[model samples]
Target: MIVHSFPPIIDSGCRMLVLGSMPGAASLQAHRYYWNPRNYMWRILYALFGDGREPDEAYEERLAFALRSGVALWDTIASCERKGSLDSEIRQAIPNDIPGLLADYPNVRAIVCNGSKSLAELTKHFGDHPEVRSRELIRMPSTSPIPTRDYRGLEDRLEVWKKLLEL
Candidate 1:
């Protein structure tokens, strides 16, 4: 059984919040989000940063970049039991304390869930609070490697993500 031992580290100054459904095994093992290889989040973010640098093992640096750019990171589910890293296997869903987090951080102007699953979970709990809903609700493709071919390539996805910076 996988446990969410800690809340996701988010920047208080973030104007945008990017949420994944849950961390993969790699991420859990690493004690960090988006730690899996072939997960395009790092690549996509690096493109947005305009350094043309590939994502190295330095996750703190990447996270720092996001924070510096006014973006926050987290997942919708606080915890779940899963037989595997597959998002579909997630059961006994427990919603994270998102509203509380948002209340604490005043700068978040938009929320972008990474996939449909996350959107469903958020909507189920929040019940169309436009203050949270109106902030951006884009249907971003998942960065997980388990499901294939759902996402645009790194560069293309980064183009879409760039809008967060504009907001």
Candidate 2:
């Protein structure tokens, strides 16, 4: 099993936090969120921001934009054991200290789970907490390539995410 190395990166100005189940191989290797070419995160954000921007922009640039726009990216699990990079194969999942992270970033008001796995883990672990109960839970499509086998394109998957930006 590979060791989970990165700590969550959150913005003090983040009004919304997007949580995924765990990082995939590309992300872990790049030490950045959505590092895989197939990951739709960058594309979706570029669509939200406007076209002239290429999805190939630097990772820091993308992260800076999200931080400036009050959006934070992280994962639900602090650590987990998996033989491979697939989120679907993650075993011995342990929910991270989300409340502590939220407390550190006081501006966060809504929590958006990247998919059902994250939502399920969050609910399973912290659903009873007062802060968790108060936060808005958004269930959006997973950006992992694994999910696309059963779903449509990123544009279709990101429809709910666009609506989320309105909030």
Candidate 3:
């Protein structure tokens, strides 16, 4: 199946850009980023930036909160063929115009890749671009529900992701 990424949830004030590989099945079905309840992206963001409360259920509210927090969201892959939500399944990936976006939004000081795939794709496609090299590039653990030996729980992942607060 061919899946496409959403438009960037970005603004002029954004200082941080979070890039995922692409929207997964649940997110695509719901027309939102990290729509899967088990996904820790929202939870981690709220834990770090919110007032010690659960993230708002409304996607609009979440986007607003992220923007207000000086963060933006997007995907490394503009479109790809994938059998499932796993990044490993992706093929024929066409990258988004990351350099163009960065050129337009110069305020962004850091680029956070949500997982290995996102980082790999970004490096493959845009590593040499001046816009990308100018900013701090970060590779974060995937916020997907799937567990890994290193990041098997929210607390574990949250600890590593807390570095975003420092940026």
Tell me the deviation in Å of residue 95 in model 2: 1.9
Best by TM-score: 3
lDDT of 3 by residue, 1-167 (tens): 99999999999999999999999999998889999999999999999899668999788999999999899999999999998788999999999999999999999999999999999999999999999999999999999988898988799999999999998
**TM-score for all models, in order of appearance:** 0.87, 0.90, 0.98
Write the residue-wise lDDT of candidate 1 on 1-72 in tens digits: 966724766767788788888888888899887887868787877777647776656778878887886778
Candidate 2, residues 51-105, lDDT tens digits: the string is: 5367646777888877776778888887888866776688888878898888787
Worst 10 residues of 1 by lDDT: 144-153
Which pairs clash inside model 1? none
Residue-level lDDT for 6 in candidate 2 = 62
Against the reference, the lDDT scores of all candidates come to 0.75, 0.79, 0.94
